[model samples]
Target: MVLQGMAAFRIICVVLLAALAGASTAQRPTYRAPQHTRAPLPVGATPEDFVAFANGGMQIERDRAPDDELAEHRRLVSALDGLLPQRKGMVDAYVVSIALDSDPVFGREAREAAKVLARRYDAAGRTIVLAGSDGTGPSDLPRGSPGHLALALARIAELIDKSEDGLVLYTTSHGAPIGIIYNDADQGYGAISPNRLAAVLGALGVDRRLVIVSACYSGSFVPALANADTAILTASAGDRTSFGCQSDNDWTFYGDALINHALRKAQPLAAASAEAVALVGQWEQQGRLKPSLPQVLIGDRATAWLAQLDRRTPAATTASVGRPATALLDQR
Candidate 1:
């Protein structure tokens, strides 16, 4: 059997290649606004805002945001009009990938992950990505935030036929025990607790879905989202933490093992997940760091939809790319 518990050995490593990624923001909102009335980060936020979040708490006040900011957000959200409708009689997969933090690492991971997921699920025009500038040229894609995620899900719901179509949602961010965090550099602070996410999906009726969350303490989402028709994968258990969130790196430990390595092959989710967990455990041991204890939950009813999506993944696996996450930890 695979190792049972595994994450916290950073003390021995001379090279602090990455900081322990920390989650940001305050409590989740009690009620969610409708997609039409959703909001994004303010156009102008002071560095002090980031300091506040760094200090462990911030009440995001984008509700009184300026007109121009709201206008820009509207344009970005409106761009989702390009998400093509599903062809009748065929099962469709809509991929939504987002980087909740402004860290370039998450941006790179989220962008590439969208491509991988889209190709795997055959979701060409059915894909939507939300991320911030990673020192790359101007991008029309809106920054990741709770509002935009809600908007994307709501839009996909309209286009996808609930009977057979599915949603592949991938999120990369620093997670707290509370939930996956929503932090954009200095502004847009909040957490998407399991309850909140469960409510949203339950409300939208997006039953056939695959959600992969990369963040510390991400497994906490399992109990809420797990069901006969849903599959959930997390980088770490609810109390443990993951690695390779260094802002400068290309992939987090979990991202590299799962997406860049295991999923690249035409294997079943169980095999891929097993490979990823093994890789993560190996790295944690090598780095003398505690294991993040990656978690996976596959419901029985999800097997059919998973098989359908698996049939379309690339025939040949791609060569692994990017710096090794453990090496980053090894470097001083």
Candidate 2:
């Protein structure tokens, strides 16, 4: 009986020791969570993580198609090299480019132009792009649709909502009696009235708003967004269509001209608008379509802006309007 009791006690002690060891192993110290990854978000954390994750995924996908993606990267980087000034993280001025490629409903020219601009922004390591098709488009898109356009507006809100500096908008699309269309899917149904766009952009209270509209009768966008620091560049009057490239079958004549020719000299938005107007007028006269003349709606200090560009950046390249390098922007 004494031996039996002693054996039972020994068994109990062993079992308890094993259980304690198991518990201790299970309770090993856990690693600390990352600052940005805690249960609650940190104060002053811009949605930068979300943007970074999205962009990183996009880059991985792009790498899967190296040949095509690499060419696109080069093109966009070239555009950025020509357009944006290199600086530390925050750009004093913000340029947003939105391309509505998914809707397949309208505004092919505008969509293409958006791709160009987005690529430009991306190469500069900026997330101001509001692109939907991952940077490419289907061969054909319907005219005067607003589906993609609306999406672009929403993304712009996300990017610019908390931004304190000046913001510039560059848009290209098809236009009509009602408003601008992102594609055929949105033509009549999804059209964003100029008033609605104005309201949406105005809600952000941007210090400066510059919009470039490339479409038939794009002139209508001016009155809506016009304000103390706003400027609008329209491809044509309300009744007319703007001519664009046909080889690639793109219809964005205004974007091709503005970027390839007028902007090459690195002029301010005001001077660039003037040269674009004259060039478009000349191109329109030559075409059988009798394209509408481009117009500029300047802010109160428009000339001051033009002068400011002279002080800020080096002079634009002196290449003529019809140069071959300019051909890419006009191509399909």
Candidate 3:
């Protein structure tokens, strides 16, 4: 009888422990990966082929006939031919908008923001876009691959008389602590390190620069990109994630607040940044999410340059016309 009782007790204890474990697991938040639509590609395509397609660079296919390679090369050449010619004289500001992800949301936001910046800065002939194929349309170039982005910057650097021209580079994508994610869907995938970006800027020799990185953990770029002649703006701090990255949305939390709202006004970027940061905080609090804490670093030289730029360009006399503020309140 004693042995039977002891066995029964052990079984009961095991059952209780199992129940507690199950309860604990139920209390823990479950993680669901965000669903993404995978882009289509040719069968048996290699990574090299994907890279070539994404960058619009060399064509590589060992099995394919020479004619096939030539055809692809010609197509890329035609695309390159369509790019806008660089301006000859000093430009007020040259804007290069890059949407590094294949997500349509980032592409749309980047393109819209680029247009706004161009209009505000009177840089109609000086703006370039490198983005993925979102339903919206083709950018100045297809594929925001690292190679293409680097090439675009180099080309702009070579064309512009760097003495008086300022470059505004706005990049939007997903990010990790190491770097901003660069994925052209099935075409190619990579990351742009902060150091790589700094080197690009250094090689460009453009002293007056505004670098805006809209991505999670983008604050990691600030320390590397910030300098006497540069201003760096990031969507979130190194340890947090920003929201509103849905494909159906017009913009992310930071992009909407900063580029679509604050920057749309005639205020200096510094003031606009502050306003956007505050707005983001409010949105995050309302949603009961952890604070993203958008970040900005304004270099000494950029301050004077921005002041001069603001003086040259007057603020919009009219209010922004678009989705009402209420519509964007729940966006994040």
The numbered model that scores best in lDDT is 1
Q: Candidate 3 residues 245-273, lDDT tens each?
A: 55545578888888888887888889989
Candidate 2 ranges with C-alpha deviation above 4 Å: 1-91, 101-123, 131-164, 184-189, 245-247, 301-332
Assess candidate 3 and give its lDDT.
0.66
Which candidate's TM-score is highest? 1
Better of 1 and 2 by lDDT: 1
Clashes of each: 8, 16, 0
Q: lDDT, candidate 2, residue 24?
A: 18
User: Which of the two candidates, 2 or 3, achieves a greater TM-score against the reference?
Assistant: 3
C-alpha TM-scores of all predictions:
0.80, 0.55, 0.73
RMSD of each: 9.8, 24.3, 13.3
Question: Which residue pairs does candidate 1 place in steric collision?
Answer: 6-291, 7-290, 7-291, 8-290, 9-289, 9-290, 15-331, 15-332
Global fold similarity of model 2 (TM-score): 0.55
